[model samples]
Target: MTIKKFQGRTESEASEKAKKELGENCVIMNVKEIKPKGFLSAFKSSTFEVTAAVEEKEKSFDPSTAFKNMPKAKSVNVVANEKIEIPSFNTSPVKDRVITPAEPKADSAISMFSRTKEKEEKELEQKISNLQSRIDDEIIKKEIEAEDKAEEQKSSENRQPTKLKRKNENFEFIKTLYEVLIENEVDEKYVNQIMDEMEKVNWGGNNVDTILSAVYQKMILKFGQPKGIDISKKPSIVFFIGPTGVGKTTTIAKIASKYKIEKGKKVAFLAADTYRIAAAEQLRTYANILDSPMKIVYSPEELNGAIDEVKGYDLVLVDTAGLSHKNETQRADVKNLIDSVDEKYNKAVYLVISATTKYKDLLEITDTYKEISDYNLVFTKLDETSCYGNLLNIKLHTGAALSYVTTGQNVPDDIEVFDTQKIVKQLLGGR
Candidate 1:
């Protein structure tokens, strides 16, 4: 008998392979399932191995008779029932071993087939369990991602502003008010600050007229009233200082005429401006017209002596030289000259600024003169420019008490004490 083993993934496949290799007459000796071991256990699958066999029958021959009937000329010989031996040329001795096939155990094929079926069922169950877990994980992940996306979208929608009812009624009103103020030369920063305050308070009940009325009231509060002159000190020394072309001389003349002619107070003039040729002569003309005593001082010592001579007068008005704040030497000279005034005299310093001057220049002049004197403000040339924002701008920045505003070139007639309501009305586009 010749035996061979056949292997396949299953018992049916193994049995088919055994029949194909061993022919139709082959008998199946055994069927077994072999499971992989060691490192190959994870990768190699369990396989069914079937042991099969085929019978080979031996043939008997009358050797003695065949040898006797052979031809004499032929070299071949056949020996009958008397044992015959064959001779070999090689002299090496060798031992021979026999390998026997094991007999099939009772009902082992049926038991192995049953074990393979059980293993297949277990593998199917495991695969189904893994697939179910993966599906569950994917579903949970998708749900969480969807929820997060929805929350993020909702948060973004809440942060963005929605459309307002009545098409943002207050927006156009506030915009128009802002434009009008800016066109009239109000500082953009000031306008924006005011607007921000209004928005904070939610003022004016959705009407432009009401809003403007509230704004005008706010302006009155910010631009305060003028400070009055102090009458307690005898020979109150009033000094005028500022930039050129701002009418410092003319402003002093207005105050002098008001005190001397209208109020019937004794007033004297001291001219300390030697830089300008006509400055002293101009004041002398005003002094002659008002019939007030006028003196020209060449130095700080003369200025002190001039103050002494005017001691008996009710007021002493000192007119200073108009020097540009850009002139370092002249500014320092003016500062030093004013510093020489005696403490015995009551002094009031006044800075005269032009309303027609640029806001930037006005601020510079105010800052420079601050080093020379502590003073109140007086704005000139109010009649020269339609834009009066410069007056408010300077007052807002300098924090100086405004004493007077000169409307024109006329001495007493053009000058008026700083009136807050009148200026605020002009700023609001009123009379």
Candidate 2:
């Protein structure tokens, strides 16, 4: 008997293959559906695995006159070419009987049956040994073939490059740029927009550097320009709101220090962040260093009083408690505090975001924040990461302009006013 496995798109195809190899008499043992593995297999359909077997046919057994025509054993002596009359044994206990020479055949055929059975056993053993050897050889051959196929598959996979490797130079540039944007945590939709724009350009060139510059220019055109602080009143109220640990307080301090020391404009600190321990003290410490007065407001009414205290000052930088976007009550409270401010003071709200945040989370946070307060974006922790695609992503997503970007922890020196050319340089991996 021999067994083999065959696979094809359909059961009929697999059965045909099995029959071609194992003859029409092969028996179908098992059938199963199987899917291939690997990158390309994702697009391929499943196949059927069919196990079939074939066996050598054996002769039918006969009982009556089984050894009547059996050949005489070589050990038996023939007398004058006469047929030899083999002796037969009687197993009955009544009387022991033996066949005489006159009897051509034995009525009790025990001895004759014993000799014939022994010869049949020897022939069956030889056939079984040959079948076992053939089965072993087939198994070894299949194993070797499997090993060779594995090696070939590994080699083919290793040699595979990007699917776009053979595309035109312009396409290569666009693909590389798309990867860079995605690596920088840019939103997929915005990345697609960039790609679509890149595809529209009529320019032709293979130089990667040139293509990078072209992409940078296109981004700049899309990002547009940054908006400056709106200090149109005596005390322009600028509120900084964002998720916890995004450095909202620090960013407010930076802007405050810049206005007070460098620009010589009167600036006061107002913090409504009573949730965290020593939240007010943190701002007080910075205020003390700059010889500026700091005020802590616990409620909306107190926030109104704080705004009145800073009415004579040129600028009022307000820092609210960092709340998770998931906390709806706290976010609404922050929005109420901003609403309580006097309408006389020109208001400018800035949503402080961390540059290191993932694009998906940023989108969620911004979406939630947009429902509470409309504001321009202020990005912090630029020094901590290299991915700036989020900057353009947020800009395009919210239709808001960027105001300030903080590079490091320094109070006055680390903050930079948003500039288009500078941003283009940063986006292109420049210093």
Candidate 3:
């Protein structure tokens, strides 16, 4: 893997630089705002610094060739070592036996009868000999088969360690990776999915780098690409909604700052979070700082009116009251506010969540909002937690596009477009 860093006036620019230099396959491993340093730094804007990585391609290893040069076991020949002997029958007695002429006719008849009996006995003896020979042949065949089997077993025993060693190595590496993911709080279900997917890959060897690269790529693909605010078309209204104390207000401020200050887009703020006086004031303060218009509306009708006021603006970010997911009334209020938006306006909803939230609560929170609207996800307080499994968990569960993530309380500076590569690397225990 090759890792390097690039800087630009914006994150996308820096990312593009990385991709251009490292090839399009390069992934952004980390992203940070590099604040201008020195005495006159306040006059200069901060630039984005991104760490990017790309796997170095190498010749593929063929597993079939691992034992291609092994010595072959010699063939066994059982019949070459043993000799067989056959017993000969004496026929002199029959030839030498004389027929007496005591009574010419009677002696001749008696001799004929004796000769017939001798012939019958000889035939019976010949049959026994043939049967014995057949038995010996069968015995030799069985002995030969047994020897061949023994040789094959010995050869297998000799080769077993090499095969077993490779298997054990692969198993150990996978186990370690599994443990690392679990330790980082990745859900067992997702861990199993990742490992199962790995099993399907035709990785030629158990090299740590190869396996890690495969897993990293799988996770990146799982995360897909993150979609942030779209300003390609003017007059876009974005609504921020989530549970209480999830930093929704602060997140809105960060995004508003990015657009108004960095991108120079005409930004407006619509504060529907009338339940909390401080939330409204917080947004107002940000609006004042950004020199953008701010409005406070208590009803869906008022929100639509506020939207109309910002029709000429490039972007309007709406902040909704954070309420318990269990409260159906509050949920309905949010749903109504979103539904009240005029179909003529292009609107988007964002579900802001705290990274430190428990996985179970995250699930419940995401499930609740899912009933209200099809919104994108924006995670906050990422600096407070080391385990980012919930990020992946919620993303997978909600199947929502991840937008921005806030790392601290610093407006604009603490927030950035969700870097899937960074989160995936952290999940895999990378720095």
Candidate 4:
């Protein structure tokens, strides 16, 4: 018998390959699907291997009468071209042994054929024992591989939940942040815009700290840069204008004290708030404290005259009357006061607003002043309100640069340059 193994991409293909090489009479001994092993095995293809055997033709062999005269055995049954397991027999001298009649003459063909059959059976048994040993080894190897695979699969299953839990935690953390923004009175529109921007960033890991840092940086960028009074020019005229009772006069005094007392610059006060006598008097008090010049201008012509008086001064801070945004005549007066400044001198406008104002009123006030002139933002009364949403809202509404934020009525002491980081941290529920 001749035996060989053939392989193909599938069982049928392997069978066909074996048949093509081993002929139609070939017997299939075994068929096994061979799978690639290891981590990258999933990317590879599996194959089938077929072991086949064929019997060689013999001219002297006669199958019809070969075993006709052979004596029957009690334990053995043989099949052609198939593996057989031989039974073990006791070989002790005391054990019973079968005794048969004497064989035919040695010259006879039957006697010679019988001896050949015995020799072939012994050789076949030896081959079967060797094949069984190989099969046993392969079975043990496959079992160990299967156990290792099962352990690896269990480990993978154990680790899957940790990844899922972290993802869920990240989602909850973001949700909490959203709630914090809402609770802080941040406008829904701006809050959504911030969250949408955060989503667009490609953070390799969705760690909570990483997400928080990203959100902080994004808000800081959105706030842009805060610009204060620029006194680089020989004379800088800064106009403070806003609606009624938003701390316009006091904010001006604070700025004046900062430039006059702290920096020792040549500062002057121009009070354009003729509608309120107390407003002019309040500014006069601050001007007297700093020993600076004070001028009250009632019209555009008066404003130009007042500008000439303060020509040699390094800084001129103007305080405008706080009036209703609905009053068209007052809005026009403030606009004229700002436009009356001489072109040769540098001028800056600041729109003072209160932090405690309602968002709706803030929108209206900012919109009204936007038509007057381009201005920077100054938010006052920060100590009265815990929520600073209006500050951000007005800043975005006007697209104006933020200049100063005052926490109290104290001149210069309660005021500081706009701190974008501090405001963002408070918005995100941090101290």
Against the true structure, what is each candidate's TM-score? 0.59, 0.58, 0.63, 0.72
Q: Point out where model 2 deviates above 4 Å.
A: 1-167, 205-213
Q: In lDDT terms, how accurate is model 4?
A: 0.81
- Superior by TM-score: candidate 2 or candidate 4: 4
Full-model lDDT for every candidate? 0.76, 0.77, 0.82, 0.81
| Residue lDDT tens for model 1, 94-206 | 21111221212433553344455557667876887777677667867988999999999998776543323212556777777677677667788888877887775464344
**Model 4 TM-score on a 0 to 1 scale:** 0.72
Question: What tens digits encode model 2's per-residue C-alpha lDDT throughout 1-431?
Answer: 55567888999999999999779999999898998644346689989988887774543444333344333666453332222344222222221232333453554353454445556766776787777677767877988999999999888776553323423666766676677677776777878877677656543423556667777888888787788687667888889999998888888888888888888998888989888758788888889988888888889888777888778988888889999999989989998988888777788889999999988899899999899888899999999988888898889888888989999998878898887788767666577
* Candidate 4 residue-wise lDDT at 171: 74
Task: Determine the backbone clash count of candidate 2.
Answer: 0
The Cα RMSD in angstroms, rounded to one decimal, for candidate 3 relative to the true structure is 39.2
Candidate 2 backbone collisions, by pair: none
Error of 4 at 95 (Å): 26
Given candidate 1, what's the lDDT at residue 20?
94
- Model 3 stretches with alpha carbons more than 4 Å out: 1-160, 202-206
**Model 2 TM-score, all chains together:** 0.58
- Which scores greater on lDDT, model 2 or model 3? 3
- lDDT score of residue 373 within candidate 4: 94
Per-candidate clashes, comma-separated: 1, 0, 0, 0
